[model samples]
Target chain A: MFTISLVGPPNSGKTTLFNKLSGQKIKTVNYPGATVDYFSADFDKKYEINAHLIDTPGIISLIPTSIDEIITIEGIYSHPEFGTPDLIITTIDASQLSRHLILVNDLIEANFNVVVIITMNDILARKNFSIDENKLSEELNLPVFKIDLTKDNGIDELIHFIKTEVENNFEKRVINKISEDTFTLVNKYNRISEIEKKVLFPTKTNSKNITKDFNNLHKPDEISLKIDSVLLNGTWGLLIFFLAMSVTFASVFWLASPIMDLIDSAFALSSESILGIWGNNWFTQLLANGLIAGFGSVAVFIPQILILFLILGILEDTGYLARGAMLVDKPLSKIGLNGRSFAPMVSGFACAVPAIMAARTIPNKRERLLTIFILPLLSCSARIPVYLLLIGFLVPTTGSLTAGIILASIYLLSIISSLVAAGIINKLKNKVITEQDHSSFILELPTYKIPRLNNVFFNAYLSTKSYITGAGPIIMIFSVILWALTFFPAGIDNSIYNENDSFEQELIENSYASNIGKFLEPAVSPLGVDWRVGVAIITSFAAREVFVSSMALMFQVNISDEDSIQKSLLKNMQKAKKSDGTKVFTTSSIIGLIVFFIIAMQCVSTLAITKKETGSWRIPILQFFIYTFSAYFLAVISVNLINFFGIA
Target chain B: MKVRNASQLLNGEQSEILGIDYNHPSARRIIEVGFTPGEEIKVIGKSLFDDPIAFSIRGTVIAIRKSEASSIIIR
Candidate 1:
């Protein structure tokens, strides 16, 4: 298979072009050991042999400043041991060809056998800018293909070109000494300029058309000044960030309610049907109380996850994310971080896995690692269920809205704490890792286009499907284990336990006699949690959502109906007392628990990703320990502080 | 000397390209995006941020820092 590398600046439609030519839609993955993004596709052309196309990250220069740029440069230079690219297909937006020619020139100088793919030809046509293809080819001494990627024009021609070149082993010499002796060359020949002038001509006949059409493209300076005006001085930017965040949370809660209720009712119906068929056997009891309840708990939160992703996807696609990054950059810089860290941190609110993955964009190793380290501190969607359950139990119904406000406040507090912790860590550490000069933020604010519905729904479906299939089994198994832990040590008579209550409750009340609960009782007592909560916490380490299942199994409750489970948990927590005769979930313990969850490293998926991204287990392991310890210490302090103040 | 801010250059506006301050953040960004001093830059459009603007320079629609745009003294 022949390799063709597609290179261009960000938002130059390189990925769009790759999609058109290869007919493959793959998520761009960050190159390991570099912040640059790339995607590889195997193209099977009709006339041409199968070719491998590498879509490289955007770069403006051969000498790169940003991590992504550096990666692109390295990818270009580092000839793969297995295979080096046989041909390079450089894509440039035709309407903006002037800026793109730099990369073309650099590639030419690098001596790569190159072909230029100029995209957005329609835009050029509208602007009355005509590219004399033959003239350009003669001037540059290379093949040039122009297309509109969105319209899928010129793709077949491109494929045909690739096939022919690869088969014939076609080679073309590129100018490699543009900078080496350009001073002498400029003085000696001025010949290069003469050639350029002859080849490049502006059409004056349709100058009005050109001006009218050019209004469609964004001018970088005006946009920057506007952003500076708002971000640097105006309060509107901050207000927008806060307002958007508020709406996000509100939508998450509102959109999720109906789906959550449906899931609850479905699970409740299943439990009731199972109980009727099984007639109260231990196995039936386990199925009803442990397995069904456990899965149902986590499954209910799926709606919230879906809603959050939808909002974020829209914001990202609309190019508002870049503005948000710009808005937050100064505040972040004050704390020794930069604007690049904002995306990953925001992503952490959904799930830490992608947030950690997104950290690759940060460029600096220390900043990336620090961002990864503190990401778990953000109150991810996983913690929402725990918060809702606890807050509903403790706060009065009349002021539930105020309780929700408090929950939101705590999430903000967590972010602030994480930033503070990152700063402290940066200062305390003696290690001197070089930080990349901040790449002047020059993100292309892609024209505001209504997000494609097909793209949004397709992404949402794939994400939800993966979560259900990939993470579902682990949750089920954990539920079963939790059931066995509380269910085993068969009583002298199976009928010896109270007959009125369900088997689940019988097992928990008598759990001391059960082998598993007895084993965990000693270790969890210090945190003011019974062995039951400890077991849930441990199972949750696999995935925070599994806590719901663990809780259901531990409690031996078949309350699969969401409302029932909420009510039961609230009732149980309210009734239970510590050894000292105070309520177990006193105000302090609740705060402490929330704080613990805020700082705790609970998701295994995040750790796995960190290991993959860092190419080492050391960082993930270190992260786990640091976060776990932080959670424990903070929980202890919070509990004591609440007690000290007599708030409990 | 005619000094016009880059933002003022309408699409299809033809002017003598002068010099660029490569050290200026926006100027460096403009250059990085393939906009060199003396290169003809065509005004593109505006985005929400109103800075980090995009333009057609050297045959590519490159975005540069707005701060850099101020340094491009075009006649």
Candidate 2:
């Protein structure tokens, strides 16, 4: 089969165009290398023989600085098995054709049969710019197809053109050949100039029309000044950014609530029904307690995660994400990061697993590592239940608004700590210098179209499925082990100490004196945690959400009539005390614990991603130690400071 | 005195492009995308960020870099 490669610059809607043509809904991200993996689809028609359309990485030029670029270049030329692409389908954003043509010229000079796919035709029409198709075809002597990929316009025409060309084996006459010497040299412009005079001719009719048109349009200076007035010096831009983020957060909570509740209730019902049928056998208990409860914890969070990804994906698709990056670039850069760093860091708020994977977009290795290292500090959704549980008990005394403020403040603190940690690490490593001199605030602000619902739901489903399949097994096993640890030492009963309490409370009171709790009691004393909390922490390391399920299991066996796990946790925490009779979960200890979790490298999936990205255990191991030490040290200081202020 | 700004170039205006701000992200992007100085470039269109601007050069429809675009001294 003849191979045709789709090539373009980064963020030129190449993937979007490819998706439209190939009928594949590939995930499109804003940053470069988003499409790190290449894909190919077969095109077979009665009128034309079979052809393979391979989507390659977007490259600026043949000389590649990044891995993505190198892969694309190598894929085109160095394939020993596939040989070379028989044809190159170069897609150019219609509004950005001048820049797009550089690659076209190179491919033409390389002697590839090149067909230019002009995308974003709607943008071109809006700008009132019309390409003289015949004139352009005569100038380049190649077939040019204008397409609005998002609207699905001109697709059949494009396919028909491809069919006709392939059938005819159409080859454009080479009017200007690049010399061997010119090809070898680094001066790309000098070589292009050498060929330009022979291939290009200005038409009198088009020249007159262009001059009249130019005289009528707003001058470039006026437009630049207008942009500067709005973006560079205006509060409106910042306000828009914040407003967008607030809506994003609110939507994540609001839209996902119903779905989340449904999933939660379904699991609860299934577990209860299964327990009723199977009775209290060990296998039944495992199924009810281990599999259902453990997976349910993660499964419940999927709706929120999906909504977050969907909103993020839409912002990315609409091109507002680049603007967000640009707006925040200067501020982030002051702390030794860039605008591109924001996406993965924000993603950490949902889950650090994908956030760590998302860090691949950062070009600088040190920056990438630093971003991955500090991402866990973003107060991910896994911490929400723990925070809410503690906050609810304090709200009556502290006031509900104050407690909410404190909770929100802790999240802010996590972000600040992440930045400070990143800055400190960058300073210590002596790699604080920025190499991105080519930082352009300019972004292709794609026309704002209503976000496609199918695209949104499809992405959400795929992302949620991956998380369930990947993290589900680990969480289940961890919960089982935790259940087993607390379930043993069956003869020990604490009914005498809490005689007035129900059978469930008596069981949990016994659990505190269990062997597993006793083993971990000493280690958690400084953090003001008793044995039960210690066991919960250990189980949580498998996955952060497992903390909730572990607590649920602990409480489930201890209390028979407690309807709400949230309420039970609050009540248990309120009565809990330290060795000296001081409250175990004092305001200080609560703050300290929250702080520790915010900074700690608690997620194993994040560590796995680091291992995969770095291709070694060294970086992940180093990250593990650094984040753990930081979490511990910071938590200790916070607790001491809060105690000193008598805030507890 | 000579006019160097991309704005001075009319739509469908053909010019022998002299130089670009290689340090500019748009310039680098354009170069990376496939545009080189000394090529015959035709201005196709422009939008926000002075972006999605298109060019016809080297027998293909290539998009111009949005940043280094203003610095493209064309005649």
Candidate 3:
């Protein structure tokens, strides 16, 4: 089957054009690779073309700069591993023709079947510039189609062109203009200029007059400059960034709660009905209790994850992330990273797994690694439930501003500490590593545009789906193993968990995990955690929120399954005692627990993703131990100091 | 004619690039992105702290660090 690749330089609306052509809702964010990975789908749905449509990451040249660009270019050339695209749809931003045309010219010369697509023609026309497409196509000797993929204009022409032009491989028709060796930078420019002379009519309003005078400003639009003047101002930019972040996190709670509750009740209702239908056999119990409960806990996270990606998609689409990057560049540079680190750092708030994956945008290898190292320190959505559950016990009153301060402090602590960690690592890295940092904070602040809803929703769904599918099996395995560990050996009396009673609780205490927890108690007791807490902490490695649910189970609370049963959680935790009968959760001890959680590398999936991304177990293993031990030592020292001060 | 590296040009300064140093590994990239000799470019803006100076090359604005700008000679 014929495979066509959509290729262009960054911010040229490349993906937008692909969406128009193929009717596939790939992300059309102004930044590069909002698709994250290459997306291919059956294009038989469009215009009788029996082919697959592949959307490639934006590239500046046939020569690649970053890792993602390398992927796209390698796909284009059809390395034995990745297939060669049968046809190339070169989407050039019409307003930036002179710079974009060089690649188009190269592809034509390289003996590839080429169709030149001039995108952003409306923006060009709005700026009062014109290009004659017939003249351009005649001169270039390839089919040229002008389109504004956003407005859905000239799409039929683009589609018709694709249908007819597949039969005509332009490489057979158009003579190669220059020998490969002679295609130097000078010759490339000359060729572009000659083409420009034939096709482009000189415009009258080139008079932004930003060039001749030093310190003059030129913006394509006045509104953007005005917005940037405030939004990108050092003081204002920082304030607005925090405000934006507050809204982002706030939306995760405010928006996702209803949907999450619905899903939770749905799972509960389905399991209950199934249990009734299957009757009181071991199979029903296994199917209902083990599989349903286990899968339900992990599946509840899907909504929050989607909302996080959706907010980020909106920010990327609007070009606000670039401004945020510009705002943070100076401070980040001191930490051996630059503005590009902002995107990943912000994403870390949602999930460290994807945030670490997002670190690919940072071009420098060392900085990218540093970004990955510090990313887990960010207070991801996974940590929110853990923090809240602990905080409920740690800080008593619900209405107290102190609770908010503690929450805010945790978030702020994560961000600031990660930055400092990056800086310190950067210093050490320079002395040890042989590589020099080549990538600088060279970001193009893309023009602001309204995010398309279809694209945003598409991206959100795709990421959420990938997360579920990729992690689903492992999570299922986790749930099954944990269930077996807890369920088997029934109790001291072989009674199953019929209701919320101390008898069932005794059974849990004598379970395999509780036995393992007893063994782990010595290690965790130093931080004021009991055996049950130890069990929860161990189970928490499966996922963070499980810590709360595990704690709920150990005490056998009537409302242990309810995520919002915080009052019961607090009461139970307060009454929890060590074997010595002294209260386990002291103010100082809880503080220590909080501190330990702040830095501990707890999530298994994050470690798995880190391993996959870094291409080895070396970094992930080092990260796991170093971070966990560091958190342990920090908790120990802080707890000891507090006890000495008698401040609890 | 007095020639200066793009790094030396002040913000909003205009010059035609004379040549790029052949020794630099990324000179190929700088050139490939329409930064070759005799193409007119303007120093558009400097990011905060001025390490990365933005340049308008071939009518598209792109930012490059002073280290990279040092490789391109312009007049």
Q: Which candidate should be chosen as best, given DockQ against the real structure?
A: 3
DockQ, candidate 2, comes to 0.12
Clashes of each: 32, 30, 0
**Candidate 1 runs further than 4 Å off:** A23-49, A52-56, A61-82, A125-128, A170-233, A260-303, A396-399, A429-448, A453-502, A505-529, A558-563, A579-581, B1-31, B39-75
User: What would the TM-scores of all predictions be?
Assistant: 0.77, 0.77, 0.88
Per-residue alpha-carbon lDDT of candidate 1 for residues A80-116, written as tens digits (9 for 90 to 100): 5314567888887666655566667778778888898
Ranking by DockQ: 3, 1, 2
lDDT of 2 by residue, A4-108 (tens): 678887656776766655633343222232322566666534324367667776765555554445556777763434547777788876555555566776777
Q: What is the lDDT of residue A521 in candidate 2?
A: 81
lDDT of 1: 0.64
Q: Candidate 1 residues B1-75, lDDT tens each?
A: 557767566533544456665546445445544444455666553333544445655443444445556667676
Model 2 chain A poorest ten-residue lDDT run: A215-224
Encode model 3's per-residue lDDT on A1-648: one tens digit a residue: 566877788888887766655644433222232324657655636477766677777776676566666656666776332256678888888777767888887777667778888888876766556789999899889889887676777778877877765666434333244343323766777778677756765355555642331112122444554566576554666788879988987787668767876876677677668866764445665676568876887687788889989998999888788767766777787878777888888778777877787787777777787788888888777677788777887778874789888988888888777877777777886542334667665566677789888878987777777566555566667766776676567632333545434554766777898889888888888877688888887877777766766777786665435544567768778788888988888887878877878888887788887787777777777678877898899998888888899986
- How do all the candidates rank in terms of TM-score, highest first? 3, 2, 1
Itemize residue pairs with steric clashes in candidate 3: none
Task: DockQ winner between 2 and 3, please give it.
Answer: 3
Candidate 2 residue runs with Cα over 4 Å from true position: A1-4, A10-13, A23-53, A71-87, A109-113, A126-128, A132-141, A148-154, A161-229, A232-235, A396-400, A430-473, A487-516, A555-562, A577-583, B1-75
Alpha-carbon interface RMSD for all candidates, in angstroms:
7.5, 9.3, 4.0
